[model samples]
Target: MLLLLGLGAWAEKAPAETSRPALTVSVQQVNFVDMERTLSATGNIRPWQDASVSVQTSGLRLKEVFADVGDIVQAGQLLAKFDDTIIRAEIEQTRAAIIQAQASLEQATQNAKRIRRIMGSGAVSQQEADQVLATEKINQAQLSSAQAALVGQEQRLAYTRLLAPYDGVVSAKSAVLGAVYNPGQELFHLIVQNKLQWEASVSSRHLSALEPGTKVLMHVREDLFAEGTVRQQSPALNEQTRQAIVYVDIVPGAQVKAGMFVQGDFKLGTRKVIAVPRQALVLRDGFYYVFVLENNNRVALRKIEIGQSLPNGVEVLAGLVSGEIIVVKGARFLEDGDMVRVALAASETAAGAGSVMSFARAGR
Candidate 1:
């Protein structure tokens, strides 16, 4: 009978140890704070101005190509050259015609002068003097025509040597050596002025908050960031998407390139909020919950509403108070209505003892 009593006592003692708290957890008090509210959007980098470089004068073989795709050029810089042999020969021919016309005019002028002197003395006939004057006028007209032709040929010769119209980076090229091309053919495409901007579109509802000079932060990559400002906003919105575009001017000298897709945020305003560590929140059945410490060292699982996710923590929109203590660590192994041992640091323990001792003296 004594042995039976001992076994029963041991059984009751085992249940007591099993009923102790499952684990110790750290907790933090909720904080009330203010944070910036931002609007995010996606966009692409594009050149502020772009141009299609084409051949103005053609019908000749491409003799040499000096600039290719990805080449940077300045205004009036040589980009390519055509076979100038044909145009150069035409220019020389025009020059010779001008010289011949000049000689003819000079001879005709001398003849008219001689005729004028003889006509008064009856040595030249009236008809002959009139003819000499008319010849002189004809030769003068011929000289003018020849000069105009020479100017046109000279202009065409200049066109044979292709030059860049503005400072830009070559984005495309079609020029091939020893290949004949016609007028208006695109030989190279340039990104004019080498300037880039982000073309981003946002919902029409958020348009009023964004304006010129608003601060923007562009996410170029995981670790890289670029700062920018809103240059302008489109006055109209798309009928289908109901979105408006905004041009953002990013700072130069970044690793960003044209045609790269990027995402960014626009700082609009600020708002007051209450938040807690992200680890303190638990998600189950698509609902978020936090372990709130109650009286008697017990924990109660409380369902909470979550708002925007911040950089360090999450904003709690409802179901929590500013001064409430919630579990910070070791919450994954906990459940509702579980008795817990509040684990306090050395300093916290000292502070708690001091507060209690002061309260006891007041009660006395």
Candidate 2:
């Protein structure tokens, strides 16, 4: 009797559940999204053109400097100079060699003339005169060699002074007056003017939404209010993060500096379509649907097709239209065919304001 009574009680409860009214939910009309789909990434801000400056020769003291960090410089502008005392001395020695070679050449020419006259008069063997002529020709070649060496040495010595490679701002300085820079020592860093790029990463799944020349609005992550475009997308995705790098081109007018890390949004492109608050979309049995109320105050289940998603809402591609009443809040409680009471969004003003205030405080 006790087991039979327990079964009867469970059956009675089942009837109550079945007889209960359907779930109630607020509904929102399908709306179009004004903004396009965009992705965000966080890499770094860098100069579009950055250059490392270095010297080629070693054991030379930086004697003087005319430019420093933050200084605007033009191409070939003198930035610094090194001591050339030893180099000047070497140049002088090379000049002396050239003079000596020329003198020897003159002496050889006179000897050759004497030998030719002797050969014609039969005062010397023709073979001896030929040897003298060859010696004179050798002297002439040696003079030419010496002159070329002097020119090369002078040019190499002139390289001791450093000059700006392009019109840019000096971002770093290493070599100073009296500092000896080793061969290939880095001296200064230059950032070309009006050149900047933003580095950010986006999800690999959203790769289809990304492309070169896509417009992006980038700003510092901490302060998203400040905002730049998708300049380029990396061909390969990051294996660990499943994200890809994107570079945003920033023009000169924007108030941003290279190396200042920032965040930005990308617009995939704009489309006129259906959309609803994410809270309103529900999933059951792996199917997505929304709860709505009919003229009879009965809740209805409406399946929908979703498009691009945004922070505020999801784009509903189908099963809804503008000017149609739909649930915006309290969607989780209602079920299809259930009687539901309609509520106005205006009634939630105080609650929304309070939430906004709380969020603002948390941000601070």
lDDT, candidate 2, residue 241?
A: 88
Compared with the true structure, what per-residue lDDT tens digits does model 2 show for residues 176-256?
678887778888889976477887877878767767777767765554443455667888988898888877777556767
lDDT of the candidates, in the order given: 0.84, 0.73
Q: What is the per-residue lDDT of model 1 for residues 119-206, given as tens digits with 9 covering 90 to 100?
A: 8788878888899999999999999999999888888888888899999999889888898878899998888877778899899988
The per-prediction tally of clashing pairs is 0, 21
Candidate 2 lDDT score at position 37:
54
TM-score of each: 0.78, 0.69
For candidate 1, the C-alpha RMSD (Å) to the true structure equals 6.9
Evaluate model 1: give its lDDT: 0.84
Q: Give the C-alpha lDDT of model 2.
A: 0.73
